[model samples]
Target: MTGGDEPAPARVQAKVGAAVLAGIGPRGAEGTDGARPHSDGGAGARSRSEETVDVRFPFEGTVGLWELLDDMAAAPRLVVGDERVRAFLVDVGRRLRAPEVARRHPELASLGFFLRRSELERAAGPLPGAAGSLPGAAGSLPGAAGSLPGAAGVGGAGEFVRVPRGLVFHVAPANVDTVFVYSWALSALMGNRNVVRLSARAGGTAQAILTIMRDALDDADPVVARTQRIVSYGHPRPGARRIPVEPPHKQLEHASPGHHASSDHHQGEHSGKPPRTSPVTHPEPVAPADAGSGGAAGPTAVLSAACDLRVIWGGDRTVNEIRRHPLAPHARDLTFPDRSSFAVIRARAWLEATPATRETVADGFAIDAYWFDQAACSSPGTVFWVGSPIECAMARDGFAACLAEAVARRGWTVDTAMAVEKRVAAYGLAADGVADAVEFHGNVLAQVILTSPGAAPRRWLGTGTFAHARIGSLDELADVVRRKDQTLTHFGFDRDELAGLARALGGRGVDRIVPIGNALGFHRVWDGVDLPAELSRVITVQ
Candidate 1:
């Protein structure tokens, strides 16, 4: 996929191997061996596991999970707002924005924008100094200087420094390929040593991301790789048979680390496998709190118990499953659980909008819903029209026309299998008497007019399916809002109006209420957590 004569995959593999091995040890001030004293006073180092993880970034190899943690612990300490980490992340972002790369994977373009040097600086918010506080960053960020309690370090009475939270272990979702990057980057930017566990089923966009990161490492300070790792390991599901473990060295001999664009699956696209008809009640088997190395839970238990913080990104089941592996007394958990979102439009405003404006809104909404196949937690599952009955009906019709045109323009389509699923879901909604009218515009768009605003479906109804309803006013939506609701993307709503609705809900649901197009945008503060502040601890001196 490279413009170069060398095959992209082979070129990436060779470059990563050479650059990583060369700087594997701590250099310059820390020590020749690249090992720094464990900041946890050796307790973190003592929790080693023979279980191995397949290192995907910085290098491609299998190393014992505990050994990998030890390497991270041995690396030089990174202060909050570390320059080396910023420079490396900025370089990676720039490359991600390259015309060729962005054109190939448009989603990466958004990710690249999030990683821009300007964005990073804004997220770091002038560091710990005279400023001593963060400005309100984009996307409802917390404007606090310090949040986490003192983990270590001290200064003169009333003077203190913000320090890394030490080791952070991230368990990324099997779906959503690029999300792990945002989580890991935020932690790394805070100067914490981070280990991101990428799923084995992670799509090709993830592989491309790893390759790009490896390429950036050539110019990065050795400490960048020493303190950060992105690895993938197999964790068996409940009732699955155990596979024999292979020795690390033997596995490395055949390991391949490179771009695999040909294998790229659209992020959030359903695997060809049949969809599950019911919610998974049984937790995925994980190691018990005391499980030793070599079993499914071994790695999870060790990483969970050893890390200073654990970030879990997935559905409710995932959160419950990971919770089975206990963390240390001092460690904490930041979780993103199952969430539903919707779009809100003032019916009269939508109807009054000029054709061009309506078209633009439709286009933006299409990108948000279609990009992730309407399955992402932020993707709008329903459209709530606010107005009198007559205006609402007219506006809904206009919106359906515009949205149909927009979907066609983007050429978003579902396969025969998914199309069947969408039809089944739409009919099921009608049979349940929640849908008053069901309409389909080819396989790319389906609209269900809900019998009432309270009947809006929160669960996904296949890609491009939208359950729409009308309410007399924005205030009426409060009764319909549920705790599982997350993002509320709006068009033609003033800040005061949206904020009032949020206040009315009273933190019952909907953590993010943004413009329609920005549903997928990554923010430093997500799901009500101020990441930069949460990832670092503030030490105050008496």
Candidate 2:
């Protein structure tokens, strides 16, 4: 597809339809039959549906879970050295850098930059003579968690060499299509076989990334390339369900799922009361995974039983469903259940901002919230402004106007359902005496400034809708902090002081307090979990 003087293809990329899944391989007859759910997982497991999934590979092919897993079983585990992994991602970065290619998948463009040669080398830990770029090198962000009681030097000083967990299963969320790459890339770096279950509603961004990856790896890099598989199936919900998450690590054994079937919040934040608005009501009372099976949990159960590590990306409900399927005793899991995030700005900082500077700040915030249309857990759902009453009022109007313009510039897409949802949330908050004023970006988005924090938990909705509250001081934020509050983006705030506050004034909340602009910057150590470390085992040879 290049010009006359172009070089030969780097690797042969094939295009095949979804039916190609049939020809890859047959189900293994070993005790681990790829066709059915595990014995322990059959409690709530349902029969496999007769309909086929519309899954496909970008280089052009469709494959089923069994065939893909069989293909991987045939490949040996790769001993992924830092340089080789860096080389692979660099190649991928090069392809994404092409303007034509970059134009089509805008959502993934920034993600590609993280895999650039420079960023890859930096993230690989201390090079021969180079300094570490990120605070924790490869594990976590620099914060007080490092100094917590017995947690010092956890990933800091060690003699143990890391080894891959062998096979990784990723149940990616429907919200962000590109999230699978981050988890899959970490596992791949440790030389694991990966079967990623993307949302059945996955978009072109997912397909494009796989295409670049295939072309970059080709036949030459079988170690990394041959071990990867991407597939999706309709996530089943037999009876309208409410799910429970299995506690992580060794705790999975002692705990039963149904014990807290009535607990509404997964991370257990703001347990005051179910907001007057319930997203949807369950038709049937569903027991959490371990408690009872709803007889419709099939795909998740089958996939969970087959892998060594399962990285789930959906809301807690989805995680609760998947964990019900059960896992091999030796397998460990890390789940990124749903969490809420927000931003905090000092009124003095905003009041002092120049017109041009204000727009830049608005542009940055827009990027954070607009990337996934504020659907990501890291996206700021609320903005709490701390300052004098007069400064607070001005700050809200100025920032809202600037933010509205910036978001409009990005060509935000929101359907009629969401448009109505925002309006309802906006007016509902006003009626509930939660918001004093509301702003709109035409009919597509709404920004509500709350006079009281009460309505935020009750009516907070995302998809370009924002709710902000006025606070007299920073100390008030702690009262507003809920366990599920994830990221705190700030403008004109002290990172170290806030980090210390998160530790000293903690309510089991706020894992990350990043600069306003970088709230969405991917952290290798997310939710206090060292992903690379969690997916691998460390063996100490004395």
Candidate 3:
């Protein structure tokens, strides 16, 4: 989903060293249901005693939960930006870009473009924060397949060596299905073995994506399936009781049912030992206390305690709910919380734009607003016009007309429930004296005239409902911007003007300030945080 108050939110080869670390067989073979065998050689088939979990992508059908995690941990480790993984993702992107798929799911097309080799490489290249290294920087190591061509190694003090953060657990948002792909893809690109949790109600776009990925996996190296997984399970009700954990012994048992008790320093970097020749063996699977109940041993809890990182999406409520499930001491979270956005247009610019250009802008605005039903955190909920009162009123009227036409042209409509919701919200604002006028164009669009710029509503107001207010200058909005404000999409503004507004805000709010059409464009740096930098950790190797 394009980021509002509430937003919904591959493959590798095997080396002997990797094989040993991964505890898998040398040859690639099929497992039950046509899925590839587990990294534990062919044990993947025999281990399927219970099919409780749904493996949605790369493979489908239920599998024994423990078997899945064991395979993930045992899979051959990948250097950041491993070529095999890159190739697999690129293949999926190619499939997504197919005209038929794009026509059906425009969002998927955007995702396809984001997954392009060029874009991936660029993101995997030099990143913010780290003194020297970035995700995919493993290429700088000796004998590693170059992750980034022409990238340099750590040179001196202040330089660092970057490596994958190990198993990453992603909790994807329900409303925006494709979001999980982006979160998991980047983490995987950085060589992190991933387990993504999709909503049980994931939409068709997500299903289509899973199919593309599974198809791409067919020809990918066996390591791909061994390392990555997409699973969907029922979320335990809120306030579910937490599992009680015992203190760890020398070997820490992950708080998952059937998880093997293993030493902490499994990675070569920590162990400082040569890779073992034979696959690492494990003890028999033991069910945790409260295994079947929504307690500590539940899938979410198990994943939380087992992962090195947890990427959370949804909003404040989801973040808080997941936080109840404690993470391993070494694991941490990267959260995307509730945020709202607004649009800004210069009255002069709106009036001066060519009819075609104005139409195009309106169409783009419709996309930003309607793509996710304006429930995404990035969806613009209000419009700020800069001009005299008379000019602002004229521009508002003209823009409304164009926007309505654009919405109709795009066939975007709000159902009766949403339409009624918009009316209630709009009328409530008017009754409160915050909005002087409320207008609706059929069931597709609604406009509310705010009493003042400060009166802009931050909460969602149903799809296509936009609050309008005028300001004398762009700087005037700085006073109204709050920490919860995220994206500020605009038109008829020069770089200097936009930059000035951002500077004026001085990081108080509005992390992203882009042109209206690009409001929903996903980037490596989101919410002012460099994702590539955040996903990977740096070892200060002076």
Candidate 4:
């Protein structure tokens, strides 16, 4: 039987190369699921069984430190002023978003990736002008660096840190793809030749992005050379995944499933899992001893000491966990937690009695419920008032109706909605007391639990993407702000009342208070003082 002409060996090699370049591994290999095979492979039952090898480029120990610094210095200037380079970087970012790339590497969506692109774009762009500069283009950096064409600047430049040759970075945190990027990018940016021991789960994005960048830069370009030697590998040994016990918050997301299971099994086993042999390094570890002799070392010190800078982003749990570490005494880190954010209403003072006020209030409430699907800390978790009880109650009703309608129309599914409903239903079945009323629609649920004039900061209600809101007397709302757990509190009050509320919360250790929706967009300096400080060092050129 004459078989259809078989492809020549050269054609097969070319096909194999294309598949490999596309990030497709051999069939039956881990991570190959969702991968598309090359067209040449065409329903063939007899394709060659190829073994995949991870690409590695080692950093030589003999490279001189001064040579490294020279290379490092070139990166900032090349990246900052060059439009071509910025576009190239964006191209790399787009490549990361490709399905073939994203499925093979999940870190494209990481904060690290966001930070890398942000920092790279910022470096390529103009530096920020001094504070209080004029309104127009007179400010050197775009009103906001890396902002889409007309957006305002997010914050000032991130501090740049240079790592000398021969040092290594032990990157932790698989959940956050960008954490790896921060470490890897710093090593590349600073001209430090280094190794990145990838978190087993999320190294693909980091690996792919680095590969693309390394391939794109010219050999003679200092930035390219500095970044070229960086390498990524899983923990050399399988059992090496140990994170030091610092703040419980720092370890919360990275906590091992084994550790969690044990915690459940043993109930009181405070000593869950021993630190993995891997020396769990982060941009911020423990803060320095000098910040304060007591209390946990802030986020900045810990992260700065490890690499050059650390970039942290998440909720209150992350911030609190880092704060609770014993190393909190020695590490400096930065944190961007959901402090307080709010929505504003600029209607006329007399509008509270008019229909326009109801429309405005409804718009604000709808924003609070649906914006960013409520995951953003900036989404108003609470509301404030200036009008009489009648006005406030009317606003609340309008807000509730708007929110319910939005939920129904959009079919948004919330995480805690179902659980709350079940809990409320169970309570009704078992007890004689009046249960806190909760509303549910699919996965979106809203619950209103009455409290004494001021009970604990209202437990933010909602399941997945919903929020728990409280309608309280202004005095009672102020009292809620004083509680230790109320972070990122946004208030919607008259402009005059804002400063007073800010000062009141500031005294109680609250971090930020802003017009609600604006909370998610600002990138303030020393906001949390974790990553930026941790990843950078002060160099006084004598």
Best by TM-score: 1
Q: What does candidate 1 score on TM?
A: 0.79
Candidate 4: where is the Cα deviation over 4 Å?
A: 1-331, 335-380, 384-386, 408-411, 414-436, 456-478, 482-496, 522-535
Question: Residue 220, candidate 2: how far off, in angstroms?
Answer: 4.6
Candidate 1 weakest lDDT stretch, 10 residues? 17-26
Between candidates 2 and 3, the TM-score winner: 3
* lDDT at residue 342 of model 3 (Cα atoms): 95
lDDT of 1: 0.71
Candidate 3 C-alpha error for residue 493, in Å: 1.0
Give per-residue CA lDDT, model 3, range 1-542, as digits (tens): 22132211011111111221222211122211224434642232223323256666555455555556655655678767677888888888998998766666676778999888888887777664544344335432311322332235433344455678888988887666577888788888888889998876665566678767766765676667667888776643233233322221111222232232221211222111111112111111122221333221346655665677888887676777676556655678998878899999999999999999999999889878877667777889999999999999999999999999987776555677778888998999999999989999988888999999999999877778899999999999989999999999999999998888889998899999988888778887788877776777666543
What's the true lDDT of residue 394 in model 3?
96
lDDT of 1 at 299: 61
2 or 4, which is superior by lDDT? 2
What clash pairs does model 2 have?
Answer: 16-60
What lDDT is reached at residue 143 by model 2? 14
- Cα lDDT of all candidates, in order? 0.71, 0.59, 0.69, 0.36
